[model samples]
Target chain A: MFFYLIDVFGTMAFAISGVLTAINKKMDPFGVFVIAFVTAVGGGTLRDVLIGRSPVGWMRDLNYVYVIIAGFFLAVIFRKKLDKLRTSLFFFDTIGLGVFTLIGLEKGLEINLHPVICVALGTMTACFGGVTRDILCNEIPVIFRKEIYATICILGGCVFFLLKALHVPDGLLYILTSGVIIATRLMAVVFKWSLPPLSRD
Target chain B: MFFYLIDVFGTMAFAISGVLTAINKKMDPFGVFVIAFVTAVGGGTLRDVLIGRSPVGWMRDLNYVYVIIAGFFLAVIFRKKLDKLRTSLFFFDTIGLGVFTLIGLEKGLEINLHPVICVALGTMTACFGGVTRDILCNEIPVIFRKEIYATICILGGCVFFLLKALHVPDGLLYILTSGVIIATRLMAVVFKWSLPPLSRD
Candidate 1:
């Protein structure tokens, strides 16, 4: 039940992020709504499709759709005041990154995928929504260039598997993995750490 | 057997198209290959996932991967002479569009999806590979802005169902649908036909 609430909040955060981006692009309201919907559900949809899970998470559960709609309206209504809520928004987005990675990991493990593939799936689930959003908006994905976003998810997945190998309790394993991802993300931002772009010239 | 050959030919054309785009971007060979692979199979992968087909087409068949590799190497080797092959390239690309749209339509019909949704799927399959290639190269998708590409697919899908209603034989239906799409695309290109961008001002 608690995890479900986190999932909802994460979806809302992702939707608002997409709304902000679409509005920045000066897209029509329809475009903004489409962006919000994809940002909230695209990653999970990709993961489900990869694993042959049909109807996808959002299609089966209308709660995700409702949450995205609510988030879209909230962001549009308070676009001007959104700056004031930046800190809270960042926190929720971080929480979303961690929780989404865990969900992907769980789904992969349920299917008995290789640990390496599971990690890749987890990182993809946590990152690809933003990737798809950026692609649609005609920009290089932030994770591909500037941010340490997907890196954090990959590391979190490693932590998850490492803990499982140690026979850690499932509840504690979830907590530690998410804690690692969230804290590292927060610290990375505070420290202004970023990867240098690859150069072969 | 004939349909499979068309599918392979289409995959090769899409991959080569991706290679050309990536080369224009001055991307590394790995980047070029990634773009080619996605351009070749991304649409079918998305379609398969949407309808719950597992393992995806490429994953289930090694031939798709081999064809993409062959296409990639062929494009790279002939990069300098590619300009002279423009007519040939365009012909193959049009063939790919028609074949891919029919493949998508057939898959959707297999699952008994709504006609409207099936048309959407067909158009998506026909156009999204290039959309993805453009996105990865940090450009707007041509189909979304400047082309009459997907329109051909949608119209062809409508033609397909219309003919089916008249009890067209299955083989004839395939040929007619692809014929409409291919011929229309050729005419659109020859006549420089394009959709006007939406204007709301």
Candidate 2:
């Protein structure tokens, strides 16, 4: 139940980020909503499809769609004041990154996918929504360019498996993994840490 | 046997297109290959996932991967002469679009999805490889902006259902649907037909 709420919060946060990107692109309302929907569900959808899970997470549960709708409305209504809420939004987004990574890792383990693939899935879940959002808005995905976003998720995945190898309790395993992800992300942003682009020459 | 050949041809064409696009973007060799791989299979992958097909088409078949590799090398070797082969390349691409659309439609029907959704799947399959390619290269998808590409696929899908309702035989149905898509796309390109953008308020 607690995890579900975090999933909802993460979906909402991703949707709002999509809304902001679409607005910046000067897209129509219909376009805005579509962007928000994809941004919220795209990552999980990709993960689900790759792992052979049918109908996907969002289709089976209309709550995700509703949450995206709610996020869209909230974003549009408070567009002017969003600047003031940046920190709060960032906080939620960081939490989302952690939770989503854990969810992906768990789903992968459930299907007995290789640990490397599971880590890739975890990073993908936490990052690909933003990647899709950027793509729709016609920009190179930030994560691919320089952000430490996906790296943090990858690190968290490693932590999850490490704890599991130690026979850590399931509950504690989840908490520690997410905690590592959330803290790293927060620190990365605070310290303005970024990956260096490969040299062109 | 013939349809499988067409599918392979289409995948190669899409991969070649991806190579061209990545080259234009001045991406590294690895980037070029990655773009080509995604452009070749991204649409079918997307379709497979949406409908709950597991393991995806490519993962189940090594031939697709091999074809993409062949296409990549062929494209790179012939890069300088590609301009002179524009017509040939476009012809292959058109054939791919038609064949891919039919494949998507058939897959959707196999799953007993509604006709409308099936048409959507078909259109998505026909155009989304190019869309994914453009997105990765940081450009707006040409189909979304103003191309008769997806529209032709949708029309072909409708024609497919219309024929089915008329009790068209399966073999003829496949040919006719793909024929309509291929012919209309050829005409659209020859006549420079394009969709007009919606007026900004």
Cα lDDT tens digits, model 2, B1-201, are 999999999999999999999999999999999999999999998888788886789999999999999999999999999999989999999999999999999998887777866886897787778878988887877665556788788899999999999999999999999999999999998898876542222
All candidates: DockQ: 0.17, 0.19
Instruction: Point to the candidate with the largest lDDT.
Output: 1
lDDT for position B98 in model 1: 92
* Residue B75 accuracy (lDDT) in model 2: 96
- Candidate 1 chain B: minimum summed lDDT over ten consecutive residues — where? B25-34
lDDT, model 1, position A16? 95
Span of ten consecutive residues with least summed lDDT in model 2 chain A: A25-34
In model 2, the runs with Cα more than 4 Å from the true position are: A1-52, A57-131, A139-201
Interface RMSD of each: 5.4, 4.9
- Clash list (residue pairs), candidate 1: none
Taking the tens digit of each residue's C-alpha lDDT, what string does model 1 give over A1-201?
Answer: 888999999999999999999999999999999999899898998888887877789999999999999999999999999989999999999999999999999988887777766786788788889988988898766675666788788899999999999999998999999999999999999998776542322
Docking model 2 quality class: incorrect
